[model samples]
Target: MRVRRKPNPNRNHPLHCPYCASELLFPDEETEFAWSCQDCLRVFSVQFHGQDDPPVKPEPARSSHEALANSLKRKGHEL
Candidate 1:
Protein backbone atom coordinates (compact mmCIF):
# COMPACT_ATOMS: atom_id res chain seq x y z
CA MET A 1 0.00 0.00 0.00
CA ARG A 2 1.25 3.47 -0.93
CA VAL A 3 0.73 6.40 1.41
CA ARG A 4 -0.02 9.75 -0.19
CA ARG A 5 1.55 12.80 1.33
CA LYS A 6 -0.48 15.94 1.74
CA PRO A 7 0.64 18.96 -0.22
CA ASN A 8 2.31 21.68 1.75
CA PRO A 9 0.52 25.03 1.84
CA ASN A 10 3.79 26.87 2.39
CA ARG A 11 5.03 25.72 -1.00
CA ASN A 12 2.38 27.71 -2.82
CA HIS A 13 3.30 31.00 -4.45
CA PRO A 14 1.06 34.02 -4.77
CA LEU A 15 -0.66 34.25 -8.15
CA HIS A 16 -1.39 37.98 -8.12
CA CYS A 17 -0.23 41.19 -6.57
CA PRO A 18 -2.31 42.10 -3.53
CA TYR A 19 -1.72 45.80 -4.17
CA CYS A 20 -2.26 46.31 -7.94
CA ALA A 21 -4.20 43.08 -8.70
CA SER A 22 -1.70 42.30 -11.40
CA GLU A 23 -0.75 38.76 -12.41
CA LEU A 24 2.57 37.72 -10.97
CA LEU A 25 5.18 35.97 -13.06
CA PHE A 26 7.73 33.34 -12.19
CA PRO A 27 10.90 34.35 -10.36
CA ASP A 28 9.25 37.28 -8.59
CA GLU A 29 11.46 39.11 -6.11
CA GLU A 30 10.73 37.15 -2.92
CA THR A 31 11.64 37.13 0.72
CA GLU A 32 10.64 34.87 3.58
CA PHE A 33 7.12 36.28 3.82
CA ALA A 34 7.03 39.11 1.28
CA TRP A 35 6.91 39.52 -2.49
CA SER A 36 7.66 42.50 -4.71
CA CYS A 37 5.25 43.35 -7.49
CA GLN A 38 6.83 44.57 -10.69
CA ASP A 39 3.65 46.19 -12.02
CA CYS A 40 3.01 48.41 -9.01
CA LEU A 41 6.64 48.28 -7.88
CA ARG A 42 5.44 47.60 -4.38
CA VAL A 43 6.52 45.11 -1.77
CA PHE A 44 3.83 43.22 0.13
CA SER A 45 3.92 40.69 2.93
CA VAL A 46 1.42 38.25 4.40
CA GLN A 47 1.51 37.07 7.98
CA PHE A 48 -0.34 33.99 9.14
CA HIS A 49 -1.36 34.03 12.78
CA GLY A 50 -2.27 30.32 12.66
CA GLN A 51 -5.66 28.61 12.82
CA ASP A 52 -5.97 29.16 16.55
CA ASP A 53 -5.76 32.94 16.19
CA PRO A 54 -8.74 35.12 15.43
CA PRO A 55 -9.03 36.88 12.08
CA VAL A 56 -7.67 40.40 11.95
CA LYS A 57 -9.83 43.32 10.99
CA PRO A 58 -8.20 45.52 8.38
CA GLU A 59 -8.40 49.27 8.75
CA PRO A 60 -11.05 50.94 6.64
CA ALA A 61 -9.88 52.82 3.57
CA ARG A 62 -11.78 55.91 2.48
CA SER A 63 -10.97 55.30 -1.14
CA SER A 64 -8.80 53.27 -3.50
CA HIS A 65 -6.25 56.08 -3.61
CA GLU A 66 -6.10 56.18 0.15
CA ALA A 67 -5.68 52.43 0.33
CA LEU A 68 -2.80 52.51 -2.12
CA ALA A 69 -1.18 55.32 -0.24
CA ASN A 70 -1.56 53.48 3.04
CA SER A 71 -0.14 50.28 1.61
CA LEU A 72 2.87 52.08 0.23
CA LYS A 73 3.37 53.91 3.46
CA ARG A 74 3.32 50.66 5.40
CA LYS A 75 6.00 49.28 3.07
CA GLY A 76 8.16 52.35 3.81
CA HIS A 77 7.70 53.77 0.32
CA GLU A 78 7.03 57.46 -0.26
CA LEU A 79 4.39 58.28 -2.83
Candidate 2:
Protein backbone atom coordinates (compact mmCIF):
# COMPACT_ATOMS: atom_id res chain seq x y z
CA MET A 1 0.00 0.00 0.00
CA ARG A 2 1.05 3.58 -0.62
CA VAL A 3 0.30 6.70 1.29
CA ARG A 4 -0.24 10.12 -0.19
CA ARG A 5 1.09 13.24 1.49
CA LYS A 6 -1.05 16.28 2.00
CA PRO A 7 -0.27 19.40 0.03
CA ASN A 8 0.62 22.72 1.62
CA PRO A 9 -2.43 24.38 3.08
CA ASN A 10 -1.33 27.92 2.27
CA ARG A 11 -1.14 27.12 -1.47
CA ASN A 12 -4.90 26.72 -1.37
CA HIS A 13 -5.37 30.47 -1.02
CA PRO A 14 -6.79 31.81 -4.30
CA LEU A 15 -4.77 34.31 -6.22
CA HIS A 16 -6.42 37.61 -6.99
CA CYS A 17 -5.62 40.45 -9.35
CA PRO A 18 -4.44 43.32 -7.17
CA TYR A 19 -5.63 45.86 -9.72
CA CYS A 20 -9.11 44.72 -10.60
CA ALA A 21 -9.66 42.95 -7.30
CA SER A 22 -11.06 40.02 -9.25
CA GLU A 23 -10.17 36.39 -8.72
CA LEU A 24 -7.31 35.55 -11.02
CA LEU A 25 -8.22 32.60 -13.15
CA PHE A 26 -5.42 30.21 -13.87
CA PRO A 27 -5.51 28.61 -17.28
CA ASP A 28 -4.86 24.94 -17.94
CA GLU A 29 -1.43 25.80 -19.22
CA GLU A 30 1.92 24.71 -17.95
CA THR A 31 3.95 27.78 -17.01
CA GLU A 32 6.69 28.66 -14.61
CA PHE A 33 5.16 31.78 -13.07
CA ALA A 34 2.94 34.82 -13.59
CA TRP A 35 1.52 37.85 -11.76
CA SER A 36 -0.86 40.78 -12.33
CA CYS A 37 -2.41 43.30 -10.02
CA GLN A 38 -6.13 43.24 -10.76
CA ASP A 39 -6.81 46.65 -9.30
CA CYS A 40 -3.77 48.43 -10.73
CA LEU A 41 -3.18 46.05 -13.61
CA ARG A 42 0.41 45.82 -12.49
CA VAL A 43 2.02 42.69 -13.87
CA PHE A 44 4.78 40.87 -12.01
CA SER A 45 6.57 37.58 -11.72
CA VAL A 46 6.59 35.13 -8.86
CA GLN A 47 9.22 32.69 -7.60
CA PHE A 48 8.33 29.85 -5.27
CA HIS A 49 10.21 28.77 -2.14
CA GLY A 50 9.48 26.38 0.69
CA GLN A 51 8.87 29.12 3.30
CA ASP A 52 10.65 32.13 1.99
CA ASP A 53 10.80 34.69 -0.85
CA PRO A 54 7.52 36.39 0.02
CA PRO A 55 9.29 38.33 2.73
CA VAL A 56 6.79 39.68 5.21
CA LYS A 57 6.66 43.14 3.61
CA PRO A 58 5.04 45.19 6.34
CA GLU A 59 6.75 44.41 9.63
CA PRO A 60 10.44 44.80 9.12
CA ALA A 61 11.10 44.17 12.83
CA ARG A 62 9.80 40.60 12.90
CA SER A 63 11.04 39.25 9.56
CA SER A 64 13.25 36.39 10.71
CA HIS A 65 11.91 33.91 8.18
CA GLU A 66 12.52 36.34 5.35
CA ALA A 67 15.99 37.14 6.61
CA LEU A 68 16.82 33.46 6.94
CA ALA A 69 15.56 32.75 3.46
CA ASN A 70 17.51 35.62 1.97
CA SER A 71 20.61 34.46 3.78
CA LEU A 72 20.14 30.92 2.52
CA LYS A 73 19.60 32.12 -1.04
CA ARG A 74 22.76 34.18 -0.81
CA LYS A 75 24.62 31.07 0.33
CA GLY A 76 23.31 29.43 -2.88
CA HIS A 77 20.90 27.01 -1.21
CA GLU A 78 18.08 28.05 -3.58
CA LEU A 79 16.19 29.47 -0.54
Candidate 3:
Protein backbone atom coordinates (compact mmCIF):
# COMPACT_ATOMS: atom_id res chain seq x y z
CA MET A 1 0.00 0.00 0.00
CA ARG A 2 1.22 3.54 -0.81
CA VAL A 3 1.50 5.88 2.16
CA ARG A 4 0.16 9.39 1.47
CA ARG A 5 1.68 12.39 3.17
CA LYS A 6 -0.30 15.51 3.93
CA PRO A 7 0.79 18.71 2.14
CA ASN A 8 2.29 21.49 4.27
CA PRO A 9 0.23 24.70 4.27
CA ASN A 10 2.99 26.95 5.62
CA ARG A 11 5.68 25.84 3.16
CA ASN A 12 7.10 28.63 0.96
CA HIS A 13 7.56 27.91 -2.77
CA PRO A 14 9.92 29.63 -5.21
CA LEU A 15 8.03 32.19 -7.30
CA HIS A 16 10.82 33.79 -9.32
CA CYS A 17 13.57 32.39 -11.55
CA PRO A 18 16.87 32.45 -9.67
CA TYR A 19 18.99 33.14 -12.76
CA CYS A 20 16.89 35.56 -14.81
CA ALA A 21 14.79 36.81 -11.89
CA SER A 22 11.71 36.46 -14.09
CA GLU A 23 8.40 35.45 -12.62
CA LEU A 24 7.99 31.70 -12.91
CA LEU A 25 4.79 30.23 -14.21
CA PHE A 26 4.01 26.71 -12.98
CA PRO A 27 7.63 25.81 -12.15
CA ASP A 28 8.29 22.15 -12.74
CA GLU A 29 9.86 20.16 -9.94
CA GLU A 30 12.27 17.68 -11.51
CA THR A 31 12.80 16.00 -8.15
CA GLU A 32 11.90 16.60 -4.52
CA PHE A 33 14.42 19.47 -4.28
CA ALA A 34 15.23 20.33 -7.91
CA TRP A 35 13.24 22.99 -9.82
CA SER A 36 13.37 24.15 -13.46
CA CYS A 37 13.27 27.81 -14.49
CA GLN A 38 11.34 28.38 -17.71
CA ASP A 39 12.82 31.78 -18.57
CA CYS A 40 16.51 31.00 -18.06
CA LEU A 41 16.09 27.31 -18.95
CA ARG A 42 18.21 26.39 -15.97
CA VAL A 43 17.71 23.62 -13.45
CA PHE A 44 18.50 24.36 -9.83
CA SER A 45 18.01 22.71 -6.48
CA VAL A 46 17.08 24.22 -3.13
CA GLN A 47 18.24 22.72 0.13
CA PHE A 48 17.84 23.62 3.74
CA HIS A 49 21.26 24.11 5.37
CA GLY A 50 19.97 24.79 8.87
CA GLN A 51 18.04 27.31 10.88
CA ASP A 52 19.56 30.82 10.69
CA ASP A 53 20.56 32.91 13.68
CA PRO A 54 17.85 35.04 15.22
CA PRO A 55 17.41 38.43 13.54
CA VAL A 56 18.88 41.47 15.24
CA LYS A 57 16.34 43.76 16.86
CA PRO A 58 15.78 46.93 14.79
CA GLU A 59 16.48 50.35 16.31
CA PRO A 60 13.46 52.31 17.47
CA ALA A 61 12.04 54.80 14.93
CA ARG A 62 13.35 58.36 15.29
CA SER A 63 11.05 61.37 15.46
CA SER A 64 10.98 63.85 12.56
CA HIS A 65 12.92 66.48 14.58
CA GLU A 66 15.59 63.95 15.59
CA ALA A 67 15.93 62.76 11.98
CA LEU A 68 16.37 66.32 10.70
CA ALA A 69 18.97 67.05 13.38
CA ASN A 70 20.96 63.96 12.39
CA SER A 71 20.80 64.92 8.69
CA LEU A 72 22.12 68.41 9.51
CA LYS A 73 24.89 66.96 11.67
CA ARG A 74 26.01 64.78 8.75
CA LYS A 75 26.17 67.92 6.56
CA GLY A 76 28.50 69.58 9.14
CA HIS A 77 25.77 71.96 10.30
CA GLU A 78 24.86 72.76 13.93
CA LEU A 79 21.24 72.97 15.04
Best by TM-score: 3
Per-residue accuracy of model 3 over 1-79 as CA lDDT, tens digit each: 9776555443346777678887663434465566677777887766565787669967889999999999999999999
Provide the lowest-lDDT 10-residue window in model 3.
4-13
C-alpha local distance difference test of each model:
0.68, 0.54, 0.70
Q: Which stretches of candidate 3 lie over 4 Å from their true place?
A: 1-12, 25-29, 55-79
- lDDT (tens digit, per residue) of candidate 1 on 1-79: 9886564455446788877788763333365566677788887766565565448867665798988999999999999
| Angstrom error at residue 60, model 3 | 19
Ordered from best to worst lDDT, the candidate numbers read 3, 1, 2
Model 2 residue 2 lDDT score: 75
lDDT for model 1 comes to 0.68
TM-score per candidate, chains pooled: 0.40, 0.26, 0.43
Off by over 4 Å in 1: 1-12, 25-31, 53-79
The residue pairs in collision within model 1 are: none
Q: lDDT value for candidate 2? A: 0.54
The ten-residue window of minimal lDDT in model 1 covers 24-33
- Estimate candidate 3's RMSD in Å: 7.5
